[model samples]
Target chain A: MMTALLVMIGLALLLGIVLGYSALKFKVEGDPLVDKIDAILPQTQCGQCGFPGCKPYATAIAHGEADINQCPPGGEPGMRALADLLGVEPKPLNAECGTPKPKSVAVIVENLCIGCTLCIQACPVDAILGAAKQMHTVIASECTGCELCLPPCPVDCISMVPIPEKVDNWKWRYPVIEIKSLAV
Target chain B: MSLFKFHGGVHPPEHKLKSTAAPIRSVTMPLRLVLPLRQHVGNVAKLMVAVGDHVLKGQLLAAPDGMISAAVHAPTSGTIAAIEERLIPHASGLPDLCITLNADGEDRWGDHQPLDYQAQEKSAVLDALRLAGVVGLGGATFPSHVKLRADDAHPVLTLIINGAECEPYITCDDLLMRERALEIVRGIEIMQYLLGAKHAIIGIEDNKPEAAAAMRLACSQNSISITVATVPTLYPGGGAKQLIKVLTGLEVPSGKLPTTIGVQCFNVATAYTVHRFIDHGEPVISRVVTVTGRVAQPGNYEVPLGMEIFDLVQAAGGTADDSNGLVMGGPMMGFNLPSGHVPVVKGTNCIIASAPALFAPQPPAMPCIRCARCAEVCPVNLQPQELYWFARADNFEKARSYDLFDCIECGCCSYVCPSRIPLVQYYRYAKSEILASDKARQAANVARERNELRLARIAREKEERAAKHAERAVGARAEAGGDAKQAAIAAAMARAEAQKAEIVPQNVTDLSPLVATEIKAIDARRGKVDDRD
Candidate 1:
């Protein structure tokens, strides 16, 4: 009986090795689209896309579930870029999440802020750096301008202040190409 | 065609109770008006009248610049207040070249000449239609003359007047057919004459029984050959292709016009506009608009092009409690205005002051499980699942290969997705991106070809010069002072070359990797998550 058990174990090990070798030899190349979508999205942990985060949203889009236009923060250009990647026609950004405005970060008026955590909780990307009792400060560079944090501030202390235009941040809008579209 | 249609259409709840039964109503001339130059599909019309210029109703304000464009005229006697870039009814909220007018209230007409279209030849009718600035009033705003002039190779045999106002909550066209059936018939006759078609067919949806009865009565009275056929009240059964299929019993081949099948289509209103343009010498300046959806009052309104969305809302008795701004056109194809400040355009069909109750605000979109529902509902018979896959993966090549360019972006696939995936948006994005890439590729190709020609030109010129120099041997010694002068010249040329090399080539590094990595990484991760979902 001991010899029989040893033989069974040896056979199982041998089978595993052969299967693993075969799997490694004939692996399918992953979709290159995943990389293209990930590149267009602003890598913020913004849950505004309804996905857990930007990365997840990109993945969902890759899988054919999520549309490229849901990210209001990405605006029309981003939608176009995603559309170009996906080979779909781009529509206007879904107006449900609000119109795409110029990039803005919710600024907390320290004097007016009631030290409430409402704004903190409203932040989809957690770009606001603060505690419950402390006046919140916006991480300007990290904010995606989704405006999620502005509404929940009980005191109305948060306002979407537009990012100051500077040489560093000022990039020309990607030139739009004329597309021949029929009235669909 | 299959029993079920294709992707991206929505069944917005029909709120036709208010205006469906109500007859079409004409309103008093708006005191002020904004007429955009680029109201149609082509180039912006050249401004013919400007600030302080007095003009009567029917006076041309902007003249067509391109062959595929239309001219603009005053809806009422008015003084031009300003001509500048103003917000027009567009989804992107971009400014358009617009002419603002303050009505004089005289509402006087110019020396109008209503013609007898039957007496004239087809070219005469087309010329008259062009001069009057008539276009397809079915919201496409395409030049009517262009459509009327069918290709000789595929001569048009029939005229299809679309009366299928199948969009929920909008009843303007239904109201028009019910109230002004005879005028519509007259319009159909004019379109028939213009195209020299064998017959004309008016397609009214079954839902509008009153409209069908009216059209049939009008057709019988005029002894017109036009047939009023009642089609199913499908949301986009009114769409050009769908209507053509329903009428002709033949599908329009993909990427080709209905004219290819010897059929040409125009909206009922467009026929009327064409009639008025040729017979009565009237330009397309005014048409019917339905003011409804989440408002205090709703009705069919005849409004001029470039009327403000806000004014339309006000005319409908102001907004209800849950007003969420406005969507111009039917809920299915209409777009939410960025601001109510945008004025109406030629394509403005209905203004829906939406609310969460009527037009439910979207919730979080969950991941798709590849159920293929989007592909199933698509009227265009497109495989939306495959599109979504390539699009999400950003594999544009694959998406294009799947005929992503053919997607009409009708918002039907996105509307029907059980997971609430916004499929129309994806198609739009893909289309735009593909266009941009294609343009880039074209420009690059043109540039490369041009550069190659330029280099070859330089080489040819060098060879020709050498041959010419060889023809004159003695002049070579005279042309150059000895070896000392040649050495000096060579040194200067070397220095100039060195300066150009140091300043130019190194500065322009290939950005493919930097960009490919920066954007592709985020996209790949997005793709990866989609795989998991």
Candidate 2:
């Protein structure tokens, strides 16, 4: 009986040492769940999710402080991806934030801009190019259609222009599969 | 010779005799030629000519933009009318940048000279071919120089010439082999010399006996020994991978090139152009196009590049009265031309005037019965039904895992599908959707990285500003020489005294008499309240 007890204690000690070493050696640096949630976000930096940007929203989601469906730019598909990652049921997008729309880019009317530099300060991606008292222009490729610059423009020169589908960016649509009844 | 068979293939009715009835003829140049910059399978060629520039026949109108791209040349002497977006001969039916050339009718050749390939370095020969704008004339217009490049690391062992011409209603390569076998054989010798290949084999479908016989005779006459093997006539047998399997008994690993196995395949017409560029000093100015199905004259014509299909139909004695529309390739794989005005590109081997009688519209697709007929006929040995299910459900990951990209879209599955489902269309949709989503994911990753970098930069700037302010404060304290607090108090007191001196009651002097009386009464009441407090 004593030998058996000693064997059990010895085994427990060895396993405990191994487990302790592994915990120390393989310790993660940061919250990996936050990084994963960030990856699923569209990174529009639009702040429709009641956070400053996509990363902060991702952090909130990771911490259970925010819902997965708060991002309008990400839309339903992104919500579903996040739900899949977090092993939760997907819910409908929160309509209070905004409705999903086609991707667009900000176009600054150079004549009406007035060189106020308000839109430049509002753009989170730094896609707008100008200095104070200078004509500003938005780099269409880099503009995430965040629409943050819209409210700050005193002259209302910034407009959201939907990107047109051309041969280069055109995508193939889903195939139409008819569900015929077998009774026929 | 012992030939190996691939996993799955179908035998479609051979409709080639209709076009092979007559020898290849040259068509008259159209009034205007619309040449798209993206005829090959790579980056669009860089335009070299401006509007109103006069170009001679075979003059370089656009140069290859990068590796794996082909140069574009003038088919006939012409003046550039416009460089604008025009409808191109593509399944997408989208308009892209095209150079509209108004034919000058001079057909003058530019200054050119044939390359003495034997005397020059192999790289020089390949470079000359690239400048000459030679490409595979078989449906896929991949640049020929890119394929001919053989390095010591992957030395080409065997060269396979594709004379299979297996697609129904297309016989451009068949006629080329029958007539210009000598030139093609000579071109094969040049490719062999460049690749340093041990031997070359020309695989022609047994259906075209005359083409096979001519190739055999030409091979005998040539100094280099080239074997002429007759592969079984099958739909999509001319596909590079399929033909390689028949001739070499080797399967190109999925997602890998045939060059990985030391084998390279070139279309027969590509060889003819290589011969013309190396010997006769000619670029790819024209290609043999088969105009068949519902036409008065169904024959192969050596049509100049950029000639509109509408004009080519006229050259072929016009279309039949019952002709419904024009298809740019074989009925199995071709798509209907958006309009007859689409021009002939380097890949335009045939133009079939499809009619209700020729190609009946498919009946509405029925639900799959799980029959394996599609699996039996798939040339790439893929499960079409499963891919169809996954695609219909928008499960692109599942479709990708099922090897959806391995499908060649030969239409054999759709041809044999009992339910009349457009299986190939589903595969095409799934493949394109996967590619688009992959692209979107990459873009999102890039945006995330850029956003992180910008945030880092902003934080760094803020820290630097804080550091600078701290440094200035430290410097000010050092200048005060151990009396910094006292100096700050003195400076604050002096600022207060300056504020006292600057203060003045300007409104008190400017008030009207009645307003001044009311102000004085209010001030007397306030003084009484203050005295009470």
TM-score of each: 0.65, 0.90
Q: Please, what are the lDDT tens digits per residue for candidate 1 over residues B199-224?
A: 88888878889999999999999966
lDDT value, residue A118 of candidate 2: 89
- Worst ten-residue run, lDDT, model 2 chain B? B477-486
Off by over 4 Å in 1: A1-184, B1-12, B116-121, B456-533
State, as a TM-score between 0 and 1, how close model 2 is to the true structure: 0.90
Cα displacement (angstroms), candidate 2, residue B244, comes to 1.0
lDDT scores in order? 0.76, 0.91
Q: How well does candidate 2 score on lDDT at residue B87?
A: 90
Candidate 2 residue-pair clash tally: 0
Top candidate on DockQ is 2
Classified by CAPRI criteria, candidate 2 counts as acceptable
The residue-by-residue lDDT of candidate 2 on B118-150, one tens digit each, is 999899999888878888989889999999999
